[model samples]
Target: MVKAGRVLALLLLLLSFGVTAPTATADAAPVLSSVWTGTWETAPSGTAPALPGAAIRNVVHTSVGGTAVRIRLSNRFGTVPLTLGAVTVALRRAGGGPAAVAGSMRVATFSGAESVNLPPGWDVLTDPVSLAVPAAADLLVTVFTPADSGPATYHRTALQTSYVAAQGEQRAADEDGTAYSAKIHYWYYVTGVDVRGTAAGSVVAFGDSLTDGNGSTTDANHRWPDRLAERLQGRRLGVLNAGLAGNRLLRDGVGPSALARLDADALSRAGVRALIVLEGINDIKGSPEASDPVAFVEAYREIVTRAHALGIRVVGATLTPYGGYSAFTAAREAVRQKVNALIRTGGVFDAVVDLDAVVRDPASPERIRPDYDPGDHLHFNDAGMRVLADAVEPAVVG
Candidate 1:
């Protein structure tokens, strides 16, 4: 009887561990309801230098918050394998700085290890860390590379400043802001940051320079999508800006063509419920194929079909007029009109946001309103961005 009792106690202990282990794994799994993604665009050629051992800090604003967070690092454009020495995440104390708020710092690891290696053309995610992040708040991510890390993968047009330590310096693991003094207007390696929650899914704004905030004030978060995020504050939906400046719809230009990158930039995101497409202007200005609206329309239709396959609704925004821009021509203008007519005629999109109607001059029809044009006649001014954001119907997004 004594031996049997001991055996029974051991069996119960094993069961407890087994049951609790699965529960812990379940808790640590990614939350499928809500996601806040900070997308990465291409950095101009030769923008990032090789790191022989340095610490780099990037500041990214979160559109939603939750109890746990994970970060993505990439070597998508690197020709050589990239080695990450260490990584850390902390809440920023102020605007575009390296400082983290006191007591809010957390160490991030990859699969229980402190370091990771990313092969050329790949991305990796850090193990989730328990942290309370607030919506629209900024977080500082610091990375250290110990080896002669080859050409860096980066995104220019961040509009927000990021910092890098001098070559061979190892201050990246420091928790304080004093060590980072150099500044650059781009993000390196870091791709997306995600938080776990039960909020309504995310909204991805996919477009070209117009949607990328080419003319908006830097660091002001005044991009139309930024304004839309501000308006959607406290709601379950978060907005992700996937606009790549100079990106096109038909063929590759500054970055991969919109059709080529759609799966990675929009569909691969966690918990995405809707997407707002504002492409084709670049194609109209540059591509020979744009002279015929059929290719552009087919590209958009493919996007809609693929998105719907993933349960994501598509919102189509009419191409804003660019009549006075240097690239504008009467032929391109006719194509633009045809595309806009198709967008308004329905069937391709779940909803329509008439940015053309909102920003175009009512009298001229083919030109941007004077107040909305920021000298370029293509991109919107700050107030114009606000108007574009306000034009989005909230009821249709979720």
Candidate 2:
């Protein structure tokens, strides 16, 4: 009875001082409903001459849906500042001529400002904008540059054609896209798009031309990663394609070396949970080829080590056959076989997907299956891309 009286007295004293007692649930903070995850991404493979005063509409495909979206733009190779007069994002119209769906466009901002500048070597993500993003849907990210900028960082083989307005035109806000009559094969400035939603995470497909969809139809989205995205639609995990055509593992070719760009293109991407590395073929065939199996194995081990440090599961894919490629030689073939043998036994990855085994012709073990080859032995056709996606172990990514 005395202890109860003391508790009452304390409460009364607090009331007298005008400090109300806190309620258990009411005083607690509200929980956030969604987390950010990467839905689509592309690495900048090289630089291009700037399009002064032009508005560019980059068409990107999504791997997952979300209530809101954000974009990443890079000037990682620029020589001067990238002045963005305005940036906007919208769902591509049904018929799609760079036009946006009505009432779906949203202006993007940085630090709450509609306009911002990115200097050389700069990489930034736009502030999130509310929009109903759907899986497999196309988005048109429009950027208007009111003045001349530096060499524009670009992904040379987007496989998807985007649009660009005439110089000195500011059509980023134009809904009809009539001003965006000119088309470009490259994805300029933009690098990635992240969505805020209930996603498990994302898988990064990091590699070279084989992964970059070099032989896939333009705007068809038939890249292996794109096919993988379709397979992962209901899994709530985004698939990011970090491939660069002609890219090498040991040295730069179409883009920075695999090791050099891994961090920016795969490791540090939004909500990365797994990594699919399909590189090394270029290194084995390109000039100053890294033919030594030891060198290649060491590089693969290094990749595994780096990815494991961040708790990312790494899946190593054996190099696909390229027998009929102009660059093929007996010595190179031996090196490829040696590397694949080591990769199958190295124990350097969390998992392994034998792309060579799946795509190689049984009759000519060193060559790709004819049905899968897209005339170029080094690249795959749409059907082959589907095979690559199906080869991945779903449990590994999950």
Candidate 3:
């Protein structure tokens, strides 16, 4: 009787453990809802507008369906007061068709001043506007400028390929005379956009220029990260691109350094799950101070540790090849190789994306394939960007 009682107790305990274990697994970690990052520009390349000055304008097209949309604008590089005037968000038809005026537009205006001044080195998020967006719908976000504020940073997004109307070009506004036309290049400093969905979490892509789509075709909306978002379609995973051009893992260059910006860019974001970190090339080649392989490894370790403490999963990407650029040198190449070796072998990262192995030319081994290398060999062309995006394992990301 004693033996039978003990057996029955053990069976009950095992059943309880099974039920509780699966519950813990189901709530493993928070998932992302949506994510995006880019820059806003005052004018298209080649044309210079007046300063103090000219009103810089661009548009954001979104197909993300939600009731509330949030816009994140940056003055991270601005030295003077930056005022944003006549901010409006609207929906457009496929292939840059006419805007959905009447009931489809929402104007985001400042309560007091026509424009909001952004102090240098700081960024601000607008209040969430209540708007209904449809799936795969294009949104046109227009900014009317009265003078040149500063360097306008923008993130370029358009269905298919399109162009941003240059300055002085007359664009028709709605009955309110607020919206205007401008050239588009998908690369903008505006940074992030989060769509409030029925889900509970979001994702952040922590990367550098490649992830920022340095050489991808402008207004085409073909950045690898963008492609990844399209793949998620309706999973309700929020994806935010925290990529900056000329950014590094250990030091600052084009924008705030990765480690320095992590808090505001990733940790501070609501309901963040996994972090896709595809940086370090700039650290290997563009470090203004000095390049030490050992020091680079230590910095990476610290980044991983900090992220893990926040319950975020870190996925490390091996630095891509840069063998033929003007900046390339045997010494720099050796440093890059060492860093890649550490990223692959080191157990710090939760997972690894072997971008180097995926993009490197078998013939040269140290150089990117001609087909994939944009003229400079340092950045990937659109096709190369696709390859890099495909290299990412969806299972690990989810």
Candidate 4:
């Protein structure tokens, strides 16, 4: 190497002649950008009774592995300021439930503090915690509050089971989880879990109960989105499900309308590369029905336009068959057929995943395949979810 004094003298000579030196780091390691992908998420569908001094153990499955992770808590439906006494994240034991894997727990802080206070209708993300998160694994995010902060923002239809601690208890940091005995299907406070150093972005599965795994086996993680995540094992793309059971595209009930909450649930999510939409069946079947197929098609186009504006590719999924359901009417079927045709041919999305074509019975055309139907006729079984996942071509996704 050249001496330091000689290098300085050379630089000064070059500067005197108005010559600039070349970058010395041309062969150095490339600088990497900060990449944080949303590995798992659930939209807030409604509010539930607050737990007060209790802790909620929200069990969430990851779509991608990472060297570090962060948690998001929500008070979107709260009328009062929500105060969290403590928060912790841990890997779950193999058998599952409240118990955590030994030495895998990490405390979550807000601005380096153990506690955080969230105002009404707002959400907050915890500071990053160094942890090794495995892909396609379970994580237990425990939240404890010492005071009654009014109605809690919650996702009402998590098909997987979560746990709730006894009242007057603050066991957010508990690893054994004996304090959490009461099993609950609701996910409280915790809205999302994000993993870093995995994929640079994620694909959002956006829709209603079909995407939410409404008819699949409980605690099986067999939702279509979950199955899709399994296929993305090393594709460098995370998968996040933004489904709401009974959610509609034109109206609000189980959650805000798909259009109204699009940004909150899917568009604004961390590092979204593509979106898969499987909504509109509810609008066709619900009371005060949206009879106009034009309305539904317009909504799909709007979603595509909005996603495209942010450089995100949109995938449209045709609504599945519901022939044997109680709300199936010939007129509603006609409306569904019209809307689906438009989605398939109207150029509403960058690509299409024809879920209805795969899950519908070839014999009846309007009914779900016998093996895939879980007796409800509208929703899919584990096998059907697998088919849906298989139908999503990796090449087509952004």
Candidate 5:
């Protein structure tokens, strides 16, 4: 028989690893909605240095307006305790960078405290700060680390530049951009932002690099989902982009597979009422078993069934042509055709978005339109991204 001492030690070990019992926040009043969510992924350690006694400013755009806002910070990939010294939120100056609009900044607290400690594999939601967050405008979330925090947790390939302070400088409360001279493309330690408002709900764009805006202009917010948010400005809906570059549907790569992270990335957001799936091209080109429509279809069906259970509507997008890519092959092209055909008529989702019909070249029918191809032949250009966004029906999202 196992000793009582051994049992106690085992329980301690599990608790150290962040295993804890669930608690209820149901009695909490004032419901808020998440207007922007960037799914967190472990940043390759050593690729970017940790912020020791420095401030990092992450610039994110909101999809809807609100009177109060809160930020979510994560240490999911850290190997040590993450200590935060100060946190602030403010409206970004028109041109971007770390600048905040004068007199618009507000201090964010955790559980009524100015600072908080986050254990490894854990995240914290800040107490709501009253700020007039405008729809489709940029917000800067600034964080200061007081000690030599180990390797940072970041989302690689943010596609928009963010600012970090030089060593020996703590600029989390700075209202100007001069204190922040260094810039990086990855967003560190921030996972999401929630707003208190009357928005109907959020729409999550779940997919791979195509949906992540690989070739779109930097700091332009021209990603298809961003354009879709712009199109949905006057409405009571929010568009949250959950795309991870090089993601797959059947197996894990850059991030967890769609099937694995669906619950956390797509369904966990605040007020999510719909999901748009546009993945599987990476699986077609990367995984041997994924070349068949059967496996891809099965995964899609599972995603639909799970979303439907939560009363969330699901929309499947037809995979676009990728003929000129280096890894393209006749077999993979055939698989794409079969999968697109299924998405168009399989009735696996509540509705369908015919992306293939909107962006394919008429002459070849198997290649992206010449003007839409951004030299990669796989991802779309800015104009193409807008076209893809324009094709999404507002009525369907509502």
Candidate 6:
């Protein structure tokens, strides 16, 4: 009996240690990962035509919570090596002005040359330093380049807002020479901005130009995802914009196709909790022969399934109104409506963001409200972009 009692005590001791030991390490909160958000606009450093429409700028009001950040620059569609003369990141005060010099500025550069060679399709350039950011703080990331090739392959679809100025100007410089003094909706090659938090987990926004904020104002970080990030300020969610201009759901085009880019864009990110997918417009518009409603639905399902397998929640965003676009036709409109129906009623997604319902005109369900359309009848202006952000449901993120 004595021996048996000792054995029982030993077994109990082992069980208690096993149960408590593992949890001690497991109980530590996750290390939150940050996402970089910005746009790829045009410039004239070489024989390349000057990109005049909307130059990128630094946005001070839009950034909220973050302790550390990393900025990504792209050489992704350059024929020649792009030269960045100097790059600086600084803090901004309220009303879109520069803040008092409370923190030191950081410099960003590539390894090989003062200029970085960006091959045909993609380039990921990181800052030379990491920044210590604070909650509800605003900072500006500025890049200076001596020249660029013609028609710099800009990221037309930038979900996060950014600011830009001429080659040798500061964010707080006088408006006469600043490229961003006059707001326009164009971006240059800086693709993303990542913020670090004390916790673990992040979210990636994956889609095309609309998700990229094609028609929104430049230097004004007013993209919907930007607003979403602002709303999620204190929550343990990090937002990354993986949107690409002319990106498709299944086919490869401007940036990488959705499926092809998935690993690099979302899965490979440091810590990902959920993926918000707002794609398929380009696929529907570009591929007339490829328009099998069933196939489109299946592809979407596959994307969600793959994400789920990786333990990531998949959030589906209904494609916004595009009935007035030059490419819009009765057939395409039918497809759009059909796909949206599936997304809304389809249980495949873990959650849904009905962008269509939010921006569509009540009188004309097929088109966007004039107030919301950024003149292209497809994209949103700054105000319209704000509505898009408001349309997102916070619960869907979880």
Best by TM-score: 2
lDDT, candidate 5, 121-229, per-residue tens: 6666777789988788899988888886787877787888889886525578789888889988888887677777777677889888888888899899888999998
Per-residue lDDT of candidate 3, residues 1-398 (tens digit): 57988977854553332211111111223226433221111111111222232223334444245666655555555555556554555666444533444576665644323346555555555555567765445555545554566665443322233223234223323423233243344433344444555543555677777877777776666677666656555665555666667777887766667787677666556556677888788877774734787887777777778777778777888889988887888888888888888889977689998989989999997899999887888888888988887887776666
Task: Please report, in order, the local distance difference test score of every candidate based on alpha carbons.
Answer: 0.77, 0.85, 0.59, 0.85, 0.79, 0.60
RMSD of each: 8.9, 11.6, 13.8, 11.6, 4.3, 12.9
The all-Cα superposition gives candidate 3 an RMSD in Å to the true structure of 13.8
Worst 10 residues of 3 by lDDT: 38-47
lDDT of 6 by residue, 5-58 (tens): 897785465333221111111112334343332211111111224333323454
lDDT of 6 at 177: 26
Residues 1-398 of candidate 2 have per-residue lDDT tens digits of 56998988865653342222111111112129777888999989889988888899999999998999988888888888788888899999987679899999899988677887775776767777999999999999988888878788888999888999885355787888888889998998888899988988899999998888988788889999999998888788899999998898888888789988888888887788899999999888889887799988888888889888878899989988999999998899999999988888888888889999999999998898999998978899998999999999788786
Error at 376, model 5, angstroms: 0.4
In order of lDDT, best first, we have 2, 4, 5, 1, 6, 3
Candidate 4 clashes between residue pairs 3 or more apart in a chain or in different chains: none
Comparing 1 with 3 on lDDT, the higher-scoring candidate is: 1
Cα error of candidate 5 at position 126, Å: 0.8
* TM-scores for every predicted model: 0.88, 0.91, 0.75, 0.90, 0.89, 0.69
Over 281-313, each residue of candidate 1 has an lDDT whose tens digit, in order, gives 988888554677777779989999988987889
For model 4, residues 52-94, the per-residue Cα lDDT tens digits are: 8888899999999888888878888889988988889999999
Which ranges of candidate 1 are over 4 A from the true structure? Answer: 1-47, 167-170, 287-289
Candidate 3 lDDT score at position 283: 76
